[model samples]
Target: MRHSVRPRAAALAILLVPAVGIAATPLRIVAEDYPPFLRDTGKGLTGPYADAFRLLMRRQGVEVNYQTLPMKRVFQQVAMQPGTCALAVNYAPGEAETLIYVGKVAPITLTVYVRQTQSEPITNIEQLRSRPVGAINIAEIRDLLGTAGIAFTPVDRPALGIPMLNAGRFDAFISDTRPDVQFIGGRGRPVKAFTLARAERWVACHAAMAPATLAMLRRALREGVFAAETLPVWHSYGMDSFFLETRQQWLQPAN
Candidate 1:
């Protein structure tokens, strides 16, 4: 016959067993067709920034699911929904308080492109004062141009801006490095020249997300796994690195 087990021994055994009920929350990430950095491969999503985000989240013990949408909708949905974040957005005026910035994953150069045949180089904002420029209908761009005293003809989409630039509808078109490169690279038409005038790209989170979640995202980006090889894809379009230099530059101080 087997001896009865001691009550304390049974209690200790129960206490030693690990809890199996907890589940990790899946991070829902929103991105657009900003290629080389974010693109749809048909098989799924693949790009330098997307890949880096995936790697970082995994290291932080977070599960991630990515969904692609139009750039404009991406921002809107993130702002309206909880448990959502958008990548590759610059610091804009009104957006500062509406979203929490995780970190700047790359330096985005907002540049002007004209036909290679054009001889004059745009070296200063003053040069654009009298000329009409093209830009996407984003508030930050409009704000930037307004602050610089540069006037622009805004287009609703980046693809439209490129063709209009080629057609000479505007004196020049303003675009950031990644989307611009992807637009030009995919186009059959030739681009005569381009030059970077400013640099600004950052990862922004929805206001609906908790402050703690934002902090976790920031920490993960700083200490998470990074692949140097993957960074070149973004560098191809003029991004310097996969992580921004400091949060201060990309984020506002807490009130």
Candidate 2:
């Protein structure tokens, strides 16, 4: 009877231990509706950045709930809420305190668009100072222009940038996503584009996120677990050139 009691006690101890990798709560992720990067397709979020993020979470066996929120709200919620994260964001000045960056998600190439008819030779960002410029109201873009002391009219979405430019509300439109600029090519007036800035976008969570979860993600990134899975998604979006790397520096553990 003692032998039987000992075996039963061992079984109870095993049962009492929580699952090693299971999360206490699903990770809550949020992103703005930026197409080709992140978008709500009515079925679900389906875009290169979204696909890559899902692959990363799935590999770690972590359950996640993704939501599409306005860009401003996405930044605010990820900054203020624990266990919450943003899908793709740039490292704006001073955000390092509130957010813990997990890994690089995508490459961003900020471009400025102006009507082809415009005779002004605007090769550099500073040249736009003489004319009104419009851009999406996001922190990264704001920081980019603000640092140069350039003021811009803010719109809520990329769709508004081109229209605002055509209506004379803005003289130039600047955006980071290529598809947004290409979207207006056939339907709208002809425009010329110039590269404004380039930077790597990242996945960031609030600093209060579980350390174990954060470590797990960083470990996955260092191990290159999702590289093979996500690189193809980048290729499909015609971004293999942008995403391909001989060495993913982000995959290296911090010094």
Candidate 3:
């Protein structure tokens, strides 16, 4: 059965507002090329999370312009540009003051991937200490590793991690959960993954955004646009549990 976040009376009124009357300037969305969430496929921006965001904005009669860039650049643009937002941004202490999170997009659990030949069993974050590890060069993951007192080399992309591991660049690679790691690991280069950290990623906008615009986004999110649009994609990935668990976060607006 389909479910939506229960809305407050005020927010329900916002949702009821006519889409045609709310036509305003297009919102500029800055996104990272994170596969299965947001990707630039060389043709255009397309991904489950990105599609859901686009759908909500369209339903609200708001035009949006999307640009794909490195995750680092995505954060920079959203921080500096007014009326700009980023998709699936993990919350960080330093960035919290600079950004206003509208709602949770999805849950991202970081995993440690290693060559199948490795002997040690790594079921926790402390096991990664002293071993060579590489992770995407992003502040969120860096903060995660830093908090655990683990050091890691920063890889420019997640796709590069497996190849680098095969070349012995690092003993382990930390990345978001991906199903194709086994295929990418290939013959004689099998890979194994361990859960390291878990957290939620959100749709965050610049602090300078107009209050009305922000309200519209919050309204759409609280009304369950995230689940409505991305449910199929999550199902396709066999992650119905993730979708079910995150529905609670969607009910509450970000502070």
Candidate 4:
């Protein structure tokens, strides 16, 4: 069942809402806790990815209350709950199809980070194999890293891994590049970066969601409804944001 939106707020919002397609009932969203993209502020959700989802869903007349959970818990909800969804899921390499993917919603650029004074810079997966690295245990990376025979420790959060990397507990940390770099800069830690893999993300729904909901989501994706809404979010964080002139003409969700 779709989660209910707050009565008074939804009532007031309905008075002001512009006309849209058939009003889908309100939904609650749970996305992975990826910072500067999707973050759990304890009070509520924030960041570019979260904000983008909110804007597009509202345009479709679907109210959303956003939250964050561990990657494991998010997928577990998708497997068990009919209306539940987990946003910001990366399309990982060699990952088995699990949930019903709703749309091509976002992108996250993954990269490797090292401490400032480290003399040896790692430029590729082969170089990282011999050294211990820190990263979240997201499935997208497992197959790629496992194939490369790389070693990594699963950190609870991306920022937590930074201090460990700086103190030499691990040789480096892998995560969405812009946010981790910002976190390190905020802490006065100088860090070096190496290009890794980039992944397209989705607002994935539980397989039990009505097929109509999934079709509606696909229409939104193909139309690029949130492209303009999310561009300024990237710029606010001082990142270069652009929509390349591809044949598809979709906005680059993230760099």
Candidate 5:
């Protein structure tokens, strides 16, 4: 009876081992609606980062599911929820503790824009101190401008701000480098009016993510998912051209 009982116990332990392993580790990914980068296809989520993440995670043997929300809410959820991560955000000063930076998936630029017909050039943030510069409410752009002591008129979304600038409702508008141009061009609005800022963009992850996951993402980025040769598709999209150009400059072999 003792021999039979020992064999039965061993068999039960073997059966439970795989289940325990499966429950112990699984990957959950949180995404937001940042068009051309991340968008809901209705059938499912799809975008440049989404596609790259899927491929990279597969290589790492991790399964993933994506959830889309407003950009502000996405950051908030990631900060408050455990085992959650948000993507495609830039590294801002105060945000270091709130999010873990995986690695730069891409290089971005932040620029300020005004109507082409406007007589004066916006050479510095100080120029806009009293003027109403439109930006997405509660976004990194707002934070950056605020830190620089530049006051702005907050708007609900980037699209609204662009049109408002064109309509002369605001003196200027601030936006991510690529999207601003692409969005303007797509709408057949004047594109030559905008100028790139001196500041460059950096990719970052939520600080609340697990260190292991963050390290895995960093390794994957270094292995070159965001490399020029790997993601040429981004160039066809008007906005990502700026991102592609910046990536080339930053990732070039050091002489």
Candidate 6:
């Protein structure tokens, strides 16, 4: 009778737990429509960064609801909205006020997109001195270009820089490798990329969330980000030029 009684108690306890697991937490994933990085593929959210984030959260026992919001809306909501997080973001100077940097998703490597027929081949940023280049004012290399005497006109959007370069407005345009590669190639443009600096990008959450939430996230990043299971997450985005080890060494401090 004692053995039968113990078995029945254990079965009853199992029924009390939620199907996702007792420790699982509900989370919301937010991102701007940054392609090849974060975008809606109609199968929920799927991109290189978004896919990796989903896999990380799934391993951490997080049930996620993803939404595509404008950059303004995403910035407004993620800082104070509990259980909400940005999938991929750069570490800007002012963001520390409202968000805590939890994990680095990857490094953003900038490059130059030059039209083959119109521009000379270039190997480095310094070579562009006195050359008219189109770039965003806030790009990481802005200071470098300034000091190097490379002049550029600021474009309102990243994609705009591509066609402006095609129209011969500037010798080259600066943009991240993935997007510039995808955007330029997609349009059947002959623009080629020149490697630039690599900077860290991260996943950040609202500051108002519990400390335990951050701990769980950090632990997930530590255990799951570079694990064997994570490799497929990148390949799922269908990018062959995306190297696996490009930022692989940054995993330790990125957490």
Q: What's the number of clashes in each of the models?
A: 2, 0, 0, 0, 4, 0
Please list the residue runs of candidate 3 whose C-alpha ends up more than 4 Å from where it truly belongs after superposition: 1-24, 41-43, 166-168, 181-193, 223-226, 232-255
For all predicted structures, in order, the TM-scores are: 0.63, 0.71, 0.73, 0.73, 0.70, 0.70
How do all the candidates rank in terms of TM-score, highest first?
4, 3, 2, 6, 5, 1
Better of 4 and 6 by TM-score: 4
Inter-residue clash pairs, candidate 4: none
Kindly list the per-residue Cα lDDT of model 3 for residues 213-250, writing each as its tens digit: 88888876764434554455445444456565666554
Candidate 1 clashes between residue pairs 3 or more apart in a chain or in different chains: 115-192, 116-192
Give lDDT tens digits, candidate 5, residues 116-201.
67787776667878888776564567667877887778875566677788888877777663344444454424233344343433
Question: What does candidate 1's lDDT look like per residue over 216-242, in tens digits?
Answer: 688766522233333333333344332
List ranges where model 1 is wrong by over 4 Å.
Answer: 1-23, 40-44, 136-139, 155-167, 178-197, 207-212, 223-255
Model 4 worst lDDT run, 10 consecutive residues: 1-10
The lDDT for every candidate, in the order shown, is 0.61, 0.67, 0.68, 0.63, 0.58, 0.63
User: How big is the positional error of residue 226 in model 6, measured in Å on the Cα after superposition?
Assistant: 5.8
Q: Give the least accurate 10-residue stretch of model 5, judged by summed lDDT.
A: 1-10
Q: What's the true lDDT of residue 153 in model 4? A: 93
Error of 4 at 9 (Å): 18
**Candidate closer to the true structure by TM-score (higher is better), 5 or 6:** 6
Judge candidate 1 against the unseen true structure and give its global Cα lDDT, from 0 to 1.
Answer: 0.61
TM-score between model 4 and native: 0.73
- Candidate 6 wrongly placed segments (more than 4 Å): 1-25, 41-43, 118-130, 136-163, 179-194, 223-227, 240-255
